[model samples]
Target: MPTDLSPVDDALADALDDERTRQRETLSLVASENYASEAVLAAQGSVLTNKYAEGSPGERYYGGCEHADAVERLAQERARELFGADHANVQPHSGTQANLAAYQALLDSGDTVLSLELRHGGHLSHGQPYTMVDEHFDVVHYGVDPETGRLDYDAVAARATETEPDLIVSGYSAYPRAVDWERMQTIAEDVGAYHVADIAHLTGLVAAGVHPSPVGVADLVTGSTHKTIRAGRGGMILCGEERADAVDTAVMPGCQGGPLMHNVAGKAAGFAEALTPAFDVYARQTVENAAALADRLQTRGFDLVSGGTDVHFALVDLRETHPELTGAAAEAALESVGLVANKQTVPGDHRSATVASGLRIGTPAITTRGFDAAATERLADALVDVLDAPDDEAVRDDARETVAELCRQFPVYDGGAVASA
Candidate 1:
């Protein structure tokens, strides 16, 4: 499929081919990235992209939406079944869009919002200053405990009481531990605030029942399809029947226009795959691999946020064991040896976000590549070797060799060919 592109547009196709080569060659530790299946890829690249279904299934603003409506309804049904929610909106273009819709449906223009601080693992859509959310709503923030690197529920409750916010947002972008949805719901209820759970990173884990779900607990649930869910690249919102019309209206006429029907097809295809027993095994291995990675890194003297993880990633605070090393430097050193990851800010970190004091390493992509705990540990050791001697070309060379061996042993696609149609 990749080869077919060159005949139409050589330059664009070559660029895509290069990206395909890079993915097959390097190791991805990015927490939010995952490889969709061949069926999903095909569905995303199908003729459905030509459709303009601007409204919900069975009701479109344009003509010739029969098949589009069918696909959208299938996606909605699969999403509802997968997450066990009463209503699902599969038209959002991204997670942040879904969040925007939730806000539109639940909050007034100047309503107060309480969410986690970005430096301590909150998403920008959760009211980071200068964003649309911050401009429209009065946004306040809570932080993880500096000492334990975990959420302080009591502190959050106190903050909610003091602020008297209209809505409270749970879920995170880089946090490694599990969240207490019931505690958060109680806090919001006590303060007369709506609860919105953005489980963008936890969708697949929750669907497989490997992690706690917020579908029935929170007032609204928002997530991205392509993270751990591997349901192509889009956003979704799940809510009770009472709020279904508001959510659907906000997503369509309120913010977004025509839905991305091709991505919807991809979502349906991927969600079908997710319903299988094999996907459950994959989700379990993903978490187990993360635990193994965390344990091995800690044993190698790296200090992790909360000292461990209960999810598909680990946040390594470089301030302790590697006092002189910045997360950016560690990321570059690892990338030099073909390991791809992102730098992040740890709790109490004063460093700028560009050169953070922590690394957010994840197992979702690698686990999708079929890695076991033994393989994950081996990769961790290679990662440490590079950090232990960043200036030494010999160390990087050895690490690169290890990455090549692992990539060859577990090719992302059959025969190392990328299936991007």
Candidate 2:
């Protein structure tokens, strides 16, 4: 019943159809994941991928660059407006590389840098020992307050004042609260340090006006396009006009060689879509759905880390649900059902980070699929049902069937109908 297709096109089309099948079949709760739009996909697959421009727009090392100029310039202008930055560099290949480039532009070898500890919700690129930047820079640690489960500005300030660091970073991979940029700026100013706000998780929210922008407060900003922006995987660095040249230079020569032009075009499409008014509603609803899910889990006797959330993610402590359940067992059991999520370590966790005591659930993908509070409530009920009967293969299979039914009803992909397997 299918139309005739060329061999190459048919193979590619089959791959895309398989992708659609996967998205429709699974409930993605990974915080860093999102479904890029059709426009984004087109841009990424555009002819821009053939270019080898090695430098910034208008100053490329290569000779032939008529279209690359337009694509790169459009990306820069849109990013500048969307984030309220004086100038934007659309070149960094990943958020980690973006942070590394910023450090390259600012700090000297072995210069002391301050950031949140990775185990306590910070990213590895933010001075984790495993990253190469650790050897280039002397790293000190900070963390959220034990009582509040949010960034303790006073503690960060005190650390900055005491250490007199070169750069002060305020960002997280797992933090769920909105950052206090003003306080962060103040602390950086007092200690004569440069501030970098990694708003990777909140870029769409900030662009949509659902969350406050962090571009002007910090000297530098780094973001990921996939998390909140609904773009494909890529990184971006934004800076004030004064440092734009240095930032660009650092990202190019200092950190990486060639740029991911395809990803940059995808970022361009994402930025355009984020500037729309409806995205504001979507971003707002993401937080609402997260809050609703967290509340439902709490009412169902799960202990939420930091008690709750103000954003799209929640780190849930599962001791109440199953006192003897290790996070590894919980994750396997939950996955056996269709309620997908990841095991995460909580503060004072008794188990290893890899085998955590809790699971981290996010709302971005389901939110993209149009699952609101009522549907999320059903999700919470499914989780509770699984926990209530941990060993029930029948229950797990039933839950998976239930999830597949929901997925079938609310299919992903631009066609509205999920491609048949």
Candidate 3:
């Protein structure tokens, strides 16, 4: 190995190298995560992070604004083209940050906001009692139908009429089926509420033409570039030209300080890559893999929320299959096999966040590594086997071997300009 590390930084460099090797050897199945291409990674590591342009392009609060202006402009333009929105602000640091900005822009303190309940299928930023959303705004919780484990739009409408919230928040972290955004917007409008859609998990599908888009339907749309978009870790707000200044100002002065230009640059690179024909293929395959995994899990007697998935991730209800094992145990067992996944809370779950009753699986990372339906089936088999035999070392070892074979068959690394570097 070529050694250029100084003595003081050598230990840190070695640890980073170990992590890189681990990523190359194992699978990363985290739903909110994806592997970036070499080009995107390189852009994120560029000199851009040194600049501190506190405001939008062409009107910065600092010197040497030309390049930062270009970077931010590229990100904004790509967002507009990808989502067909009138304006885009690529400033918020993450999905939650974007939601905070949207809330700041549209609602006042104590204003009621209707959102999916966190334990049922919503993000904490939507309004868990311990979060800032809950502290500053009154939250009206909606949830999936008790029988179907799907969003009860009728109930949501009824709740909206009763709460008369200032904003109706749509989109979800664990919903398997699509939300009726058109109807949702109508309900919000009738209740005199602003409709905001957080499309963080489904953005890439919308970009790839595989999933329905809420871009033109919702008054304000926010999403993370990292999830389905497969960009660097950051958030963006897309809205109409009428709401541009409000959204921008809220994100800038009201919420965060100077933007992380490196993240912004990576967002632009990822957005550019998302617009390509090959990325469209990848996005399509992502859904295909997810659907296959859900189906196979159901076939193996594990319950899937909402029947199955039409997106990149799904929730597996473990009550029937592993009735005695907690979600945390199942998650750990799967991890021991090198099949990465997270414990999640299912609707009607008796368990809380610490030991929930569901598992969240996504196909983005495996799909990005070129795995498809067959690979998803194999992954599902490994998860089911591990969960079934949580105490069996032999079962764990076999699953690990299977995972290794899958990784070997579908190797992934940063593939653009940075590959050479």
Candidate 4:
């Protein structure tokens, strides 16, 4: 039985209950989101949160860390096994932090770093102006091929050579195709630059062997635990034995303090789940569902970036299909009908970041709820209906009804129980 939060915090508990109800009823299509399993949730909300293990597993600054150490060790071991890395640091609080520590470990201040442009599917930590990385490093950006909306390795190589960067950052936030890690490695090698592959969005796919792994190919790798991996919110860094000490130190006293042991336990549970054969099936289905979504949307006259997807999401470039419709307008229209997705910047986008020209719809969350290709096609149809008539009250009403029916068919959480705040 779960402890009731109503007695201690009625207001917060009510809000949490409302949020749970929202998730149970809506079709969440956010590309970076996923529904963690109950086991992972329990581990995240466990008692380990109270402890302060300021150092690595076996070398803690505080006492009474036996269980914390054990959990961290298990999480690291599982991560190494899952991604085939020589070492794993499950300490950084988020993917951004993991990238920061990786940069600190590999390069010095003022060293040039070459990475993808933020509007071109790269993360903010990869050298956005607002980040500390930008303040410390000389950052150069490479962009995707405008014709294909895919990374052009030749362009990246040319950019690396032009900048003579100390590090080259690969992997992305919104790209929908498989990356050639080996080719990127070769480019970094030719430029004499260390490669840091930020696989924050494809952690589970790589772990399940559905996507190419960058662990052994890249000089350093980083990822988020919560995105595709179904772990609690956290970050991880993977590196070879030669760089293990530097990466570990950079993650600890270099960027952060005590580790979140409960989240580490959650990572362990999530990685263990990923090791099973069932997870491989889930990973493959995620990609298949995205492909189905792309097909359905393209059939309805929508223009998808790259013409389709090779991963768990599809980027719909709405410029040609709906020139007057901004991504923000489409996002609101879909949300009104219980289909939640985020506005995104497509290649050659002229709009601001807040009002992008594209929509990135993902299948990880819906797939976790047991949605297959057929169900995804239905979802795509409903999404198109809303986008086609965003301001029509009758159309939104019909879409909402369809969403409610689909929610009934595929619920996110069993028993519809909302845990206390």
Candidate 5:
């Protein structure tokens, strides 16, 4: 029972309450989602949202931007400290926007851009045919090694040599292993292209020093603050001092206007939290829990991409073991039992993206709820049971019970009222 909302707009308030209940009672395994802290949430819901600051800190298009300036500066300083970057722009509305601004800053229209194939784990903004980026740029794609389900630097190098793209994009949404940022930088350098690493999915891991940082390696780095960092829903760009002005102008006048000041406050708060020692433990536990879950899933006869994971998530390739099960069906069955996850495309997926051949399971949200390796192992068992007998009501009933018990044991958000059965 939180305050402020129940007194007004009961309809929307009830919906919010229901969502909170759902979050508390279910295991959130989405790779691109995480729960923001109360401090971060408060900051996001603050009155700062009413303000409009159209420019950078200290230099604004409107008056009464002193507080906005302070918040943005704090966010930028904290982000720079966390990622060891000479510059950080905390204004992009989302990770896609951040990447868009980066491209706009570094490359000209019709410039050749090389990025990973979306079906093979890249993001849509990297040059999906339907995106505005594709309409504006000449995009080429590289892919993972089908046999290994991992990137082959030599193959990427060969492609770069042939295409000679103006920009090379790295980082991914469904990749379970760590990226070799230095190798990507070398490839871009050899081809005389700028390297833009989008660590949207691993921002918090990198901030906690659990995953390797691309701050100094890549020519430009962009990420979403909400995914792993648990900040407000927004994006950030980090680069060297040399590229700061270009990125600033691109983000401001080029892609968007009026920075989200409330989100910037949230980013400041979340970054402050990450600077503490407790966040280190949380980040380390997130990886360890994912590994534990993967090990358990593997033992249950599931094939994982790249064999296993080195981060907060694992991509379960079901093409071999459960050829009949599409990722959509698996996702639906799991969701029915309150195990929230997403369908994903494998390296050599034959099915469409909507009904992928793989499932991406993440441990960030569950780990944030104080779930350790043992709890994750139990979750893996429940997930396997549901997937093993997705059409069986008996199996779903049993799995639902297991999930309920797990939720009760590791509740979220001050143990908010559980959703009714």
Candidate 6:
């Protein structure tokens, strides 16, 4: 990494320094974010970034792609081994891209796709309106039971039967309950639909065995490498060998060109780290910390979606408890106190996504920084202080002090970044 950029590019260097400082000072509760290891960072910033390896390993379009091929192959191997998948494609630029490629490989144009409703915890790539997926495919949606705030699989099966979709997309962005992969797969089978499980948020948990894996059960498994996996900032697809070639072609010439070899190296490094026993412990603790945070928030009278989280994050439905406080306002209030989180839409939220009725707080980044349940509970209490009185500066000030103390106790990085002088 370029530690010193002062003499050549002071402006960009200063911005990077500021961002690093922000991360070190604040608490990150974003469900889709995590701190990648130093090894992963180094790999992404290496000379491999200059290479252009267009095709899969052993059949690159570029002439000088031997090392590039090696790194990509390593990433693929590690991803397959880590997830217990028959085939792995570590090339899509993002989780959305992975989903796009999977759809391209499996579904024809205008084929009906059944996915969870975005307002009820599905990703936009899962056929939200105006997106490429929605434009190309006939999209139908299923939603959680509003009364119970949980997915009703029986309802899902009914929806699938009614839609008779060519593809069924499972997994979510903000639902805080465990998914029954087999049940979903069976539903898809009964309808003669292909199952694509987008395990983006649960990648690390699944890899670490803390969450269930959909590698074998789902026809295609897609995920982001950075979320919980702490890998390179990219996307991957896993599938049976029969579908590997189609998946590869769709990702390469089908959607993207020359893979980001540097990111691939990062994926390889992170996956290697994930294979260690410590990652499993971290994964388990992340879920435990989320549960602890949820329990603390619940005791404070915050209504969590589905009652709590089974993974690394919790979705707090603020509609019933604080009817007037919008999720955007809550997010801003928490950010004022140095606690970073995101606004989310609850099962039956009537508001727009930007001003939704929920808060999504996660523990992956905090757990990576060595925080346990006790520390998470304390943070949860601080969050409550901010949410309970968003307009109260005195409360926010107190919460900031608590946040600073916690930052001191658990620093994100060992040392500060060196800025160019």
Q: How far is candidate 4 from the true structure (C-alpha RMSD, Å)?
A: 2.1
Please write out the lDDT profile of model 3 over residues 1-421, one tens digit for every residue: 2223657699887887777667777787778777888777778888997999899898899999899999999999998998898999998999999999999999889999899988788999898888999999989888888788888778999999888899999999988787788999999999999999999888898888888888889999999997777777799999998999999999999999999999999999999989888889888888889889888988988888888887788898888777998888888888787887889999999998889999989988888888879878988898788888899999889999999998888876634112421
What is the full ranking by lDDT, best candidate first?
Answer: 1, 5, 6, 4, 3, 2
lDDT of 4 by residue, 1-421 (tens): 2335878999888888888778888988998998888788899989998999999877899999998989999999999999999999999899999999999899989999998897888889999787899999999999999999999999999988888999999999988999999999999999899999999999999999999999899999999998887877899999999999999999989999998888888898888888888889888999999999999999999999888989999999999989999999999889989999999998889898899999999999988888899999988998998898888899889889989988998877655311210
lDDT of 6 by residue, 157-275 (tens): 99999999999999999889999999999999999999999999999999999998998999999999998989999999999999999999999899899888899998998899889
lDDT of 1 at 176: 94
Candidate 6 Cα lDDT to native:
0.91
- Report per-prediction Cα RMSD to one decimal: 1.6, 3.0, 1.9, 2.1, 2.5, 2.5
- lDDT tens digits by residue: candidate 1, 321-395: 888999999999999999999999988899989999999999998988878999999999999989888999998
TM per candidate comes to 0.98, 0.93, 0.97, 0.97, 0.97, 0.98
For 4-96, candidate 2 gives per-residue lDDT tens digits of 344659887777676666776888777777777778877898888898888887888887876787887888888888888888887888888
Residue pairs with colliding backbones in model 4 are none
Q: Mind giving the per-residue lDDT tens digits that candidate 5 earns over 1-421?
A: 5545766788888888889788888889998888888888889999998999999988999999998999999999999999999999999999999999999999999999999998889999999898989999999999999989899999999999999999999999988889999999999999899999999999999999999999999999999999888888899999999999999999999999999899989999889988888888889999999999999999999999999999999999999999999999999999999999999999888899999999999999998888899999999999999999999999999999999998888877874311110
lDDT of 6 at 185: 98
lDDT of each: 0.93, 0.80, 0.87, 0.90, 0.92, 0.91
Q: What C-alpha lDDT does candidate 1 achieve relative to the native structure?
A: 0.93
User: Which segments of model 3 are wrong by more than 4 Å?
Assistant: 1-8, 414-421
List candidate 6 stretches off by more than 4 Å.
Answer: 415-421
| Model 2 stretches with alpha carbons more than 4 Å out | 1-17, 319-323, 417-421
Evaluated against the true structure, the overall lDDT of model 3 is 0.87
- Itemize residue pairs with steric clashes in candidate 1: none
